[model samples]
Target: MADIAGRAGVSLATVDRVINRRKGVKERTRQQVLEAALALGFLGADEMARFRDRREANIVFLLPAGTNPYLRDLGDHLRQRVALREEGSPKVRCFFIEGFNAPALAEAIRRNADWADGIAFFAIDHPAVREAVAEVAANGVRLVTVVSDLGHSGCDAYVGHENRSVGRTAGLLIGRFIAERQGAVALVAGSRHYRAHSEREAGFLSIQEEMFPHLRLVGMREGHDDSGQNYRHTIALLDQNPDLRGIYNVGGSSGGVARALAERGRSDVAFIGHGLTKDTRNALVEGVMDAVFHTDPETLIDRAIGAICQPERQVLPMKLEIVFRENLP
Candidate 1:
C-alpha cells in the first residue's frame, strides 16, 4: 500500500480508499492507484475479485442512422462484441442518431451524461459537439471519439484508422490505375464537417498533385453520405465533364455512384471508394468499383472498450485494409 501510494503520487489513505472501493476518491486518482497496484503485482485474489465484482460501467455508443451500410454493420459489430464478452465487463448501449445532425448528437451526449460512465460516438466536427464533449469530460465521464474525430475536443481517446493514410493509399491506387487514362477525375465526399473526410480529401489531392499530374481533378461534391444525393452528384459530374475517366469517393454512398455509372453505361470509368460492405463488394465483383478501403469494426470496438475500462493505457490507431474483387471475403 505504501509503495502503490508513492508510485501513484497519492497518500496512503487515498490508496486505501481506492483499493477498498470506499467513497470520496476521485475517478482519476482511483485509476492511478489501480494501475500502480497492478504494475506492482500487489493485488491478491480477494482484492481482484472485489474489483471484478464492482458494478458494471454503463457505456453508451452513438452512431449515425441511414443507408450507410458501413456504419450499420459497425454498430452491429460493436453490439455483438459487447454481448459475447466475459462477465464483469462494462455494459454497452448503442444509439443511432438521425442524419448526422450536430445538435442531435450533442443532445444524446447531454442526455446520457448523468448515467453513463463512458460515452463513445462517431463525432461530427462541429462547435456544438465539441462543447458537448468538453462538458461531459469536465463532469467526470470518459469520452472517446470513434471513426471521425473531433479535433482537440478534450476527449479521453480516439479509436479509428489514420484517415490521411487511408486517403493516400486510395490516391496511390487511383493514380496508378489511371496513369494511361487521358481525362479528369471527380471527388465525392459525405461532408467537410467531418475532419476525417477533409483530411482524406487533403491527402488525396496532395498525392494527385504530387504524382498524378497528368490526370486532372475536375471537381468535388458533397453527397452527404446519402445514395440519392450521391446519385445526383454523379449524374451532374458525368453530364458536365464528358472526359471524366475516374472517381474517388472519400465517403459513403459508393453504391449510388455505381448505380449512376451503370445507368449511363460508364462501366469503363475507374471507381475507387471506401468501406468494404455488401454494396461495395457487389460493386467490385460487378466491375463497378475498382477497390475499397476498410478497417475492422471488431478491432475498433475492442480497443475502445479497453480505453474506457483501462484508462491508463494508450489507444493506438487502427490499420487500414484495402480490398479488391480478388480478395473479397
Candidate 2:
C-alpha cells in the first residue's frame, strides 16, 4: 500500500481508499494507484494474470543498443514476434537503450512502467537500475531481468542463463584445451556494469585458480560489447603477451577476438566466448574459437512472456549450452 502510494505520487490514505474500494478517490488517482500497484509486483500472481487477460497486455523489452550480435538477435526475435502477434495476444515491443548507462536504463524502466503491463530488460549491476527495479516492483509491475541481472531487486522473474557457471565452463574449456596452460589467458568483457560478465569473470577466475593454477589470467579489457573495441583490446593483449595461451571473453564480440587471433596467427591460443551467433558459429567451425556458451533467444523470450502473463510459475535459471568446434550443431 505504501509502495503504491509512493510510486503513484499519492498519499497512503489515497492508496488505502483506492485499494479498499472506497469511493472518495478520483478515478484518475485511483487508476494511478492501481498502476503503481501492478508495476511493483504488489499484485498477487492470480491478479497479475487476470490483469493481463482483462486488457491488451503490453510487454516492453529494453535491450542494450550495443554492437553485441546476441543482444541484436534477441531484439530481432522480439520484433519478429511483435510483427506476427495475433489478436488478443500480448503486444510485444522492444527498445534499444545505451548499453552502459544505468541512469538512462533506470529512466526507461520508470517511463515504461507508467503504461507497460510487463517489462523485460537487459539488467546491469548499477544502483540506479536496481532502484528503478525496486520502484517498479513496489508499483507491482512484473519485471523480468534479461541477460544480466539487477541482483536481489524485487523483479518478478529473470530470463537468462546462470552466468557464473557459463564463465566457469569457458574457463574449464580454455584451460583444458590449452594443454600446456603455462602462459597467461586473456580475459575480456563487454562491461562490468553487466553482472553477468563480472560473475562470469569471477567463476572463470575461481576455476583458473582451482584447476589451472599454472596459467595467469590477465587483462580484463572492457570492450563494451563493441567488436571494434574488442578487436583493439585483443590486438593489444597479443602485442603485450607473446605467450598468450588462451582467450576467454565473458561478454560478446567473439568475432573481434577471433579476428585478432587470426591476424596474429595465434590459432594455438584456445579461444572461448559466449553466444552462438552466425560469426561465432563460423569461428567455431573454422577452429578460430575453441568453444562458446549459448542460450537460444526464443527460450529467453518465451520465459519472459510466461513470467509476464503467468508470473506465478516457478522461474528457473536457464542453462547455457556450450558449443565446441567439434560439435558445431
For each candidate, the alpha-carbon lDDT, in order, equals 0.85, 0.84
Query: How do all models score by TM-score?
Result: 0.85, 0.84
Q: Pairing residues by index, what is the TM-score of model 2?
A: 0.84
| Candidate with the greatest lDDT versus the true structure | 1
Worst 10 residues of 2 by lDDT: 19-28
RMSD of each: 4.7, 6.5
Local accuracy of candidate 1 as per-residue lDDT tens digits, 154-191: 99999988888788887888888877778888899998
Query: Candidate 2: lDDT of 55?
Result: 55
- Please report the candidate that would top TM-score against the real structure: 1
Residue-level lDDT of model 2, residues 12-74, one tens digit each, is 988886666543343456678778988898877677555434455688899999889998988
The parts of candidate 1 lying over 4 Å away from their true place are: 1-26, 31-54, 81-86
Instruction: Give the residue spans of candidate 2 off by over 4 A.
Output: 1-53
